[model samples]
Target chain A: EIVEALIRGAGPSSLEGVRVLLTAGPTREPVDPVRFLGNRSSGRMGYALAESLADLGARVVLVSGPTALSMPRVHERIGVETALEMHAAVMSRVADCDLFVATAAVADYRPERPADGKIKKSAEGLTLRLVRNPDILSEVAALDPAPFTVGFAAETERVADYALGKLRDKRLDMIAANLVGGERGGFERDENALSVFWPEGSRDLPMMSKTRLAAELAALIAERYRERHAAST
Target chain B: EIVEALIRGAGPSSLEGVRVLLTAGPTREPVDPVRFLGNRSSGRMGYALAESLADLGARVVLVSGPTALSMPRVHERIGVETALEMHAAVMSRVADCDLFVATAAVADYRPERPADGKIKKSAEGLTLRLVRNPDILSEVAALDPAPFTVGFAAETERVADYALGKLRDKRLDMIAANLVGGERGGFERDENALSVFWPEGSRDLPMMSKTRLAAELAALIAERYRERHAAST
Candidate 1:
């Protein structure tokens, strides 16, 4: 009821003519011809956000990694694999988008040099040399005329502190923090809860289907975006 | 054409009344509440095997990991996550199966103690302590009345030597070896090739859709199985 009211209050045109860019799913960093580093992101939340944002009249450009999700109803969808590919995709189009959402659960590292052939298994085991992946959100935040950036911190522990740290460190305008796993919500689940925070204010969103949560978040983001735009003007 | 003939040569009773246990897809080993160790095994080949085996009159019990593919037409489909879960699921049913196919890309190691809550990200980085998971195929091979086991070696390099070594070391009745990744084959692609190896014989299966490949492989396994049974009798 609370979230529904929030959505109803925003009205359309809150994001009319606004262009939004979103990232979703887990990036695959190849270890060899057959293997790769990946996370357990199902891309549901991100897809929902794309749909909700589009519903609010934003032209959504979705850059997604490997997932089973059908394409969201959006202006465009750019498919990618590794973090490097995603970084390239997002940076090339940042200047055209008004609001940016980073919902992807990107791997932090990739094999420094993926083998041309499969590595043979040894009884003693094998070790991989991994290198850090570029932080996409951080890069976007550093842009000269950056979009209104909202990032996600899907944490299992110490949710608030970490989310806040990312908001400050990455210079994000807002961050949505959530816990994954368990019956109520998490990876691959249909329902979720979020704690949204900005520099000066915060709101706790109760557990709900990713669809409804996205609708509410889209509305809230639109309101904040319009307020910031008006103040700047 | 050769592969099609191979399937045509096998009679309908090739695997009749055979209770086959198969494992497919890639296991998820949790690192934290929101993160896990996973690989990209689409379960395409395994699902194909299940369908083909069922068509040959085997009672197929498929234990699979997380995948985007739909359930194969088989006697039963048991979904699981993590190496531990897969191990347990396969072992519990080993008593009832006459033949076993180990196709799942089970993670060799898993986080020793996955965090109950999401781990906080630090600029410094994060490390996980992983422990070796039980070798499902090895354990099944050691069973008192072991099923005639077939294993898979999905390799990028040294495919033959490694697969043969596993065939002998694990006491497997047969092993299917394949190279992953390229224009015509490997992960996510619809087609593949395999080198089938047994104790004293080998057969090279050329590139084809996983559907056709599964049919040929199923026929070969059934023939080998019947021959072994006849000799024993």
Candidate 2:
């Protein structure tokens, strides 16, 4: 049992000396000084991945948004805010990486113009112009030196079909799909369930701790990374 | 614009009075007075669903596990701790529901004998005896008055194969699949990616807030529920 676990833990030799880049948490799109658009992301999942990657002896760069969580050990932690900042930080370091994972809940759209002062609500309803934010994963995957890019798909329906489309449309090497229905495990909760899809095969890890799932995903990513690397070579 | 939004929301008249029962958050299995095996599940998804179901005027019963978040408006909330407690609660109420969604991260195994007293540290490593916990979704689906059941498959790889298998094997009407990996969002994060699959058609909701996804899912569930109901009649 110990030996089997060890084998599973170590993964393949190709995983050695690889570099991993991950983005985590939620991006805050400012509407006003007092109010901003943000999700319930706590950054726990990203922290778990950073720890898991480090445990596997991979050099990891964890680019995080504003999160209350502490930084994981044995990795380079870059903190930023807004989707633009995250995209810049990731782009600066992505060239030197071997694997790229985008886990941040980046705002798909942002206020077109920032309110110079906090807007006091009128008796009438208010309206604010919005513009699309940067597509970080799609941008990275489109790069010439694109590392094995992985994207995340959070859907409520037709998760697999959409994931496959993203995998093809975004040109991602793989995608991790999840259902967002229950409040606890999907966001700001400590546990999660994941369905990972790749070009060849996919597997289910069931519902487990973000910590345990992160480690399991790291092992599988290493394995798949090696397989893809070998086939390309 | 409000009227237009309402019209967009009320796509046809097929989903008027659906009733839904959902489970969310993590279940704790106690081993001692102060110690228990539990994951970090926040219950955001289920609360979001409850909120959406209410918005669509569906009578909703949300059987939840322990969490810090407040209950979503317009739904009945029943909180539980142990798996057995959750099982009993779900079984008691599941029969009348028109749709059932299971998103709770229930523990797969529990300590065989929960120690009454905290074990003192010794030189030898501690060993624990574990027993399998009941599959809540499967059990509910097997019931005579089983509602339109939806289960979640969180996998690391082989997502579709495993998810579709579960949809058939567990006899679920549909399964929401998620892949857990580096940070973007899964398990305690703010956003999630989902792939919802059934025997025929499937769709995907891209990474978004669990709240928004829940609204979309509730809509889909309501539509599917009506279709299934009509087919049976």
> Highest DockQ, which number?
1
Leading candidate by lDDT: 1
How well does candidate 1 reproduce the true complex, by DockQ? 0.41
CAPRI quality of model 1: acceptable
Over B11-109, each residue of candidate 2 has an lDDT whose tens digit, in order, gives: 533344777788888787765532455554577877787778778777888888877777678558899987888999998988788788898877665
Task: For model 1, name the residue pairs that clash.
Answer: A118-B156, A118-B157, A155-B118, A156-B117, A156-B118, A157-B117, A157-B118
lDDT of 2 at B72: 77
Per-candidate TM vs. native? 0.90, 0.49
Residue-level lDDT tens digits of model 2 in A141-173: 999978999887766557688888889889998
Worst window of 10 by summed lDDT in candidate 2 chain A: A117-126
DockQ for model 2 equals 0.01
User: How big a share of the true inter-chain contacts is recovered in candidate 1?
Assistant: 0.41
